[model samples]
Target: MSRHDFYENIRNSTRLNHFANLVNLAAIDGDIKPIEEKLLKRFSRKFDVSEENYEKILENPASFPVHAINLKTQRLEFLFDLLRIVYVDNKMDEAEEFLIRKYAVGLGFSEEQALVVINKSKKLFENNFSFDFYQHFIESDED
Candidate 1:
């Protein structure tokens, strides 16, 4: 394959892994709810995952390994996507919370940082949680 095609494949693989993570989170509560499925479909589209691959991921998300995102912005966006799935039903359960924390670590956050992000996200998601606001909150801690 050409260099461009090679890089594209790697990027697509990473996106597939990320999408699998979302699928796993959605199914963590035993069955995937209708609302959760809707959100998952939307995410698949955003991630550029094909319908065939989407179904395959849903069949067994655990098969995909967690790929650590390099960019801070990407990591936060990853966390935000997880939070979106957790809150899609208008509630956050223990399983969802636990999975999200694990995912945060996989996305390169420390355990403590995961807790902080999850706790703060729970509150922010309940209000008007925009990515801009969430990014500001996280970055503000560095100053």
Candidate 2:
């Protein structure tokens, strides 16, 4: 794929979410277990990403470090939104935690910055308790 296509693919796929990639990675413990295979397949199918790209992602974990940095530069709300989706059901496994740390460090964020990011995610969870409420607030709020 061209460099542009590679970036576009990452941007369009759920794998763009570092947290989601972490969750997916957590599901597989080095081997391609059946359930993990199923989950990956489902994610690929849903995102219209080809198996080749998925394989590339698995083979090279740091290929998207720049993308992770870009995500970090975004507003805290966007970051927390991603974290919330990844940590849905209120649990983050070891693999997910590992990925988050790796990406944060790669983005050149200090330990304090990383902690602040996690704290921001927690605050997001507290501030936006429901979809309807968030929708109402987002629509009404100027700030």
Candidate 3:
């Protein structure tokens, strides 16, 4: 494959893995609720996750590796996407919150910063914030 295609594949894999991790959080209560399943299907289509890959991920999500995103803005965007996943079911449990915090830290935020971001993200969800809002907010913060 071409270099760009190669990197794109890797990025797609990472995103799929991350989404799988979020789905795992929803299933932590020993079952995936209907809402959670709907969100999973939505995310799978958004991420271009194939049926074969979906089955693989469902079979064993924890086995997937975490891949790093290099850019700060991209990392923030990634965290926001994870928050969206968490909020999709309209029920953010303690387990989901814990997993999000852990993923945020893994993405390079401090524990305190992660919590702050999570809170901000929750508000964004409540306020029906769009991707443009997130982009503008991040840009304004950099100024």
Candidate 4:
């Protein structure tokens, strides 16, 4: 494989792993709702997760690695993605919050920082900022 292809594979793998982890979190709340399943399917397509790979992930979600994306923008994007997933069904349980907190750390934010980021992201969403528009808010305020 070319170097670019290799890196692309790594990035795709990282996305798939994180996606699976989020699904695992969703399942933790007893049952996976229809909306959650639909969002999961959409995310799988976005991540280029193959049917076989998704099946493997479903079989053993713990096997996937939560590899960090190096760029802050991408990491924040992932955080927002997680927020969207957990809240798509219009519900945010403690289990979902706990899982996102774990992901925040995995995304390179400290425990305290993660809470702040997550809350900010949630508020941004509440204000009708979709993911595409939300990045502008974060990017414009880089310290």
Best by TM-score: 1
State the lDDT of candidate 3 residue by residue for 1-143, as single tens digits.
Answer: 99999998887866687777666655656777787677667667656678888777767665753455677788788887766655665656665567677677767777887787776666567656777787566445432
Across 1-143, the per-residue lDDT of candidate 1 in tens digits comes to 99999998976876777779878766756788887787678767767789999999888876775777789898998787556645655677665576678789888888998888888777677755778888888766642
Per-residue lDDT of candidate 2, residues 83-128 (tens digit): 5554554555554444455445445566766655554444445433
Write one digit per residue (lDDT tens) for candidate 4, span 53-80: 8777766665664666788888888887
Q: Pick the candidate with the highest lDDT.
A: 1
| C-alpha lDDT of candidate 1 relative to the true structure | 0.76
TM-score of 2: 0.45
What candidate 1 gets wrong by more than 4 Å, as runs, is 1-19, 22-55, 58-63
Give stretches of model 4 more than 4 Å off.
Answer: 1-16, 23-55, 136-143
Task: Give the number of colliding residue pairs in candidate 1.
Answer: 0
Clashing pairs in 2: none
Candidate 2 all-Cα RMSD: 8.4
- Collision pairs in model 1: none
- The CA lDDT at 60 in model 3 is 68
